[model samples]
Target: MKQLYYAALIYLVLGLAGGLGYREITKANGFTGDTQLAVVHTHLLVLGMLVFLVVLLLEKTFTLTDSRLFPWFFWVYNAGVVWTAAFLAINGTRTVAGEPTGAALAGMAGFGHILLTAGLVLFFVCLRSRLSTSDTAPTTTIGR
Candidate 1:
């Protein structure tokens, strides 16, 4: 959990820096149009920050005993995020350069999105089930 928290914070800082640097570069080049930097920023937030936090929270809050599904979910979710972010970054670069959108790129992006969404859904369902179990107690008191 601590590692994930640190990773999320680092990613957030990096994302901000990347966004600002990209903006500066675009401005310096006098190019006012689509930029892959936007995609990079979005990916940094979605994959690095959001996904990292979610997984970290689950690990810290839930107890997995002899459950294989949790490990599978972790790998699938992280892989999906990585692939989606990479594809988006590549596509974004092409789009920013005024290049034609090829069928391969489109398909990759679509597939990546689907995988990421599916992974997120699976993780959510698992987390929800774990949270609803009678063995897990609420963190806060009702009267407090």
Candidate 2:
């Protein structure tokens, strides 16, 4: 749970930084055209920060860490988000600098998407396994 909190915090900071970096870099370079840099900021915020925060809540409710695949999901998902965002940032920077874009960046970014997909699958599988085995139904203790 704490680990999830920290991950969310880290991604929140990274996302904010990515956005600021994009703004400053583009402004400095007089770049007015669309670039992959903006996507990097969004991805870090949505997939990185928001997803982790939601996962933290799910963990509190479902104890997802108890699953064998939870650790794998955690690491792989984070790696994918970072990998994709990094390449996007690099491509954006290159675009802003008026440099030629190439196939290698696209390939690397594609792999990151694959990793994110696999991690999402793992999360669902873990959640399903837990729900299937849970004998206790959800009960309200709000008034108690």
On TM-score, the leading prediction is 2
Tens digits of per-residue lDDT for model 1, 32-112: 777555776777787878777877766765753223466566566666666776666677656666677688977886786
Q: For model 2, how does the per-residue alpha-carbon lDDT over 1-144 read when each residue is reduced to its tens digit?
A: 999999999999999999999999999999999999988889999999999999998888788999999999999999999999999999889999999989998898899999999999999998887776564766678878
Cα error of candidate 2 at position 111, Å: 0.7
- Each prediction's Cα lDDT score? 0.68, 0.91
List where candidate 2 sits over 4 angstroms from the true fold.
Answer: 136-144
Model 2: ten consecutive residues of lowest lDDT: 130-139
> Which RMSD does model 1 reach against the true structure?
4.1
